[model samples]
Target: MRVDTVGAVFDALADPNRRTLIGFLAQRDTATATELAAELPLTRQGIAKHLATLKEAGLVRRRRSGRETRYKLTPEPMTDAIAWMATVGGQWDDRLEALRSHLARGEH
Candidate 1:
């Protein structure tokens, strides 16, 4: 997984509205901005803006059908991000375990 891709995913996910949008998309598989707006507290235009941010982060993909555009969550980028986080978390766990062992031995 690319570092930039992970960064983009994190940045896109930092917004609560965007995270909620992701959850909605995940549940529905695919939906249009108008549909999301109706379900969410935001307006259609607001939903569009959030979707655009998701698209830029590679977290979602858009398709046009007739006159309306539908958005779907793209899990690949998020998968990459999750994998990266797991790796980092593992390293931290290892370090903390080592510190615990050292402290047990009274070696600071």
Candidate 2:
């Protein structure tokens, strides 16, 4: 994934409300902001704002369904972010193993 895309995903996820919204969306195929608001303590407007951030981060997609806008999780950006994290984590793990080996050899 591009660094900026990953950064945006991380930034959008930094908010607890947004994370909650994501969790809600994940359980369904799509949902309206109003519907999501009903499930949470937030107002519909607040839910819209969080959805907008999620859309910008490529985490969700919105479509106009007759009178209301519906949002569905895109998930591709999140998948990319997960792959990037795994790569970085693997590198760190390798480095840590090397350090462990060095320590075992009692090298200064």
Query: What TM-score, over all chains together, does every model reach?
Result: 0.97, 0.98
Cα lDDT tens digits, model 1, 1-108, are 899999999999999999999999999978999999999999999999999999999999999999999999999999999999999999999999999999999996
Each model's lDDT comes to 0.97, 0.96
TM-score of 2: 0.98
List candidate 1 segments past 4 Å from native: none
Pick the TM-score winner: 2
* Model 2 misplacement above 4 A: none
Instruction: Give the range where candidate 2 is weakest over 10 consecutive residues by summed lDDT.
Output: 1-10
